[model samples]
Target: MKLSQLGEFGLIKNARDIFKSLNENIVVGIGDDCAAIKLRKGFLLIATTDALVEGIHFKLDYIQPYQLGIKSININLSDIAAMGGIPLHALLSIAVPPNISVNFMDDFFKGVKDGAKRFKVSIIGGNVSSSKNEFSINMAILGEVKKKYMLLRKGAKAGDKIFVTGYLGDSAAGLEILKRSQKSEVRSQKKRKLIKRHLMPIPRLEEGRFLAVKKLATSMTDISDGLASDIRRICEESDVGANIFTKNIPISKELKDFTSSQLKTRGTHPADGSSKLITSLNFALYGGEDYELLFTAKPENVKKLKELWKNVNIPITMIGEITKKGINLVNIDGKAIPLTKEGYNHFKG
Candidate 1:
C-alpha cells in the first residue's frame, strides 16, 4: 500500500511498533512528544546529526531501503565512535514522497532497528513527513564517554604518528565501478567487496574505544571525507602540519587488481603505468566514505599501541607523522607534493 493511504499517524504507528524500546534509561520513548533518557553518571554526552538525500547522497536504483536504513545509522554511530563514546539513543527523521510504499518503509525501519540493536542503542523518537519528489533521512545520535577517555581533533602534536584502521579506497573504487556498471549486475567477488565497502562501511568503534580507553590516541576522527580532506581538519584543529608517505598508505588487494585490469584493458605499457598508480592513489587519497578511524599518537607510544592492537580484527597502519608546518605527500620518488582537499564537499559545484 502507498504511504498516502496510510496517513501520517498510521505511518508513525508503524515506526513506533518497530522501534519500541525496553531500556530503563528511556523514561519516554517513541509514542511520546519527546524521548527522555537518563544519562549515565560521570560521563559526558556526545551528540551528532547527519542527513542523506536522494540523488545527492544516493540513488534508488543503487541502494535498497534496508541498506539505506543501516547506512543512515552507521554514519551517525561513526561520529560517536570518533569521540570514544558509546551510542545510547537515536532520533530518526525521514521525508519521502507520498507514493512511497508502506512495505518499503517497513524494510527500512527493520534495517534501522537491526543496526541500532547491534550497538545496543534505542530508537527513542523520530519524525516522518511527506516530500515532493525526493527521499531524505536524518538521524541524531546521543552517546556518552568519560571525560578522561574522550578524544578530539585538536590534541595532535608535531612528530605524533598518524594511523588508520583497515584498508582505504575500496569504497571509492566500488562507487566508481557501480556508476560504470549501471543496471548490469556485478558478479566478481573483488567488485562485490568493493561495492559493499561503498554501501555498508564498518565504523571502527572497537578500535576507537580501545585507543581512547588506553589513553593512546592524541587526536582522532573518522575518515568520512577522504584522507586529503580530513587530514586538513586535524591540521586545522591541532595547529600542526602532516607528512604522508605515498608508499605507506594502505591499499586493498582488490583495488590494486581493479586498477591493474583497467590499465591492461586499455593496452597501457608497464612503463606508462603512472596513470594506473595515480588512479588507485587518487581513490585512496580523495575518495570519501571509508568510515575508518584516522588518529594520531605520540611517537613514544607507537610500540605499545602496536603491541596492544592485536586484540582487534582490524589492522592498524601508520601512514604519516604530524609535522611542524605544511601538509604534503612524500611520493615514491621522494618528492614532496602539497596535498589538496579534494574529497566530497556537499556545497562543491
Candidate 2:
C-alpha cells in the first residue's frame, strides 16, 4: 500500500506492532521516540539504525563513496547522539550494485573504518551483498546511557523553549547543486554552502554526550527530516504544542550570501518579494539529512545550556516554544501562519 494511504503515524502504528521485544534488556520498545532497554551496569542500551540508498538518500554524483560510507555510519551515530547516549559500537551492512568495483567496496569500508575511528566506535559484524539498481549502506548503532540520562522525544512540557544546533538548509543547498550540475555558470554562494552542507553533515556526537551528561535536554530528536517534521514528532510524542519565532531561526551567513547571489543572477524573486528566499530556508527547515540535534528545555535551563556548551560548533537558538495544542509558526509581525512542510519523505519525491 502507498505510504500516503497509511500515513506516517498510521504506518508506524501498524508496523510497530510487529516489533516484538528482541532483547531481554528492552524495557520500552519501538513506540516511544527512543527505544529503552534495561541494562546490566546502570546503563540503558539505546540502539538506532538508519540506511542510505544511492538515489533515495544520496546520489553518487554529489558525494564520494568514501564520504557516503562515512555518512551512512555517522548518521546513525547522530541518532544515538540525539538520545544523549555514548556511542560504543556499530554494525555495518552494505549492498553494492554489481557495477560497483571491489576496490570501491574497499574504499567504502575504509571510510566506515575511518568514521568508527573518529567516533571512537568499534565495528562488530555486518553483511555485504550485491544490488541491482543502487549501492546502500545501513549502520546499526549500539550506545549506552545512564538510565536517568536517556533523552526522550516525548518529554517536552508546555512553556519549554525549542532549540536547534547549528545553521539549517545547507543540505538542501547541496541537493540543489546536485540538481543543477551546470557548474560552468555562475552559482550563488548560498548554493555552494548548501552543497557543502549536504556533503558533510557534522554529527553532534560530542554535543549529544555533553547534553546527556549535563542533563540539559527535556526531549530531543535529530533534524533528519528537517526541523518541521522532527519537531512535529517530538510534539506528537509529548502530546504538547510548540511555538518558535521565525525570527529566532539562525540562518547561516554563508547560506544567505549564496542564495542571494542565485536569486539576483537568476532574476528569481520570492513570491512575496524577498521572502521567496524562504525556499532555501524552508529546505533547511524541512529537508532531511541535516542531522543536527533539536530538543526542548525549560526556560530556566536556557542560561545554563548556553553557558555549558558555549564553545560548540554554532549557537543554539530558541526558534519557538512548546505549546499546549498544535505546531504553530508565527511571522515576524506576530501573525499566525502555517508552515508548509517542504522536507523530504522516503516514498514521496
| Top of the candidates by TM-score | 1
Candidate 2, 1-349: lDDT as tens digits:
4332444354334324322324455555555554554446878778888888787777786677677777778888889889888876666666666565545555666677677778777665555565767877788988889878889898999999999888777676576557757646676565666776787677898888788778898999998877877888899999998776788877777766656657634422211112244355565666667888899989999999999877776668779999898787887899876665445566554
Off by over 4 Å in 1: 264-278
Query: Residue 140 of candidate 1: its Cα lDDT?
Result: 97
lDDT of prediction 2: 0.72
TM-score of each: 0.95, 0.81
lDDT of each: 0.88, 0.72
- Candidate 1 per-residue C-alpha lDDT over 226-305 given as tens digits, one digit per residue, 9 for 90 to 100: 98988999999999999999999999999999877876343211111123443678788888789999999999999999
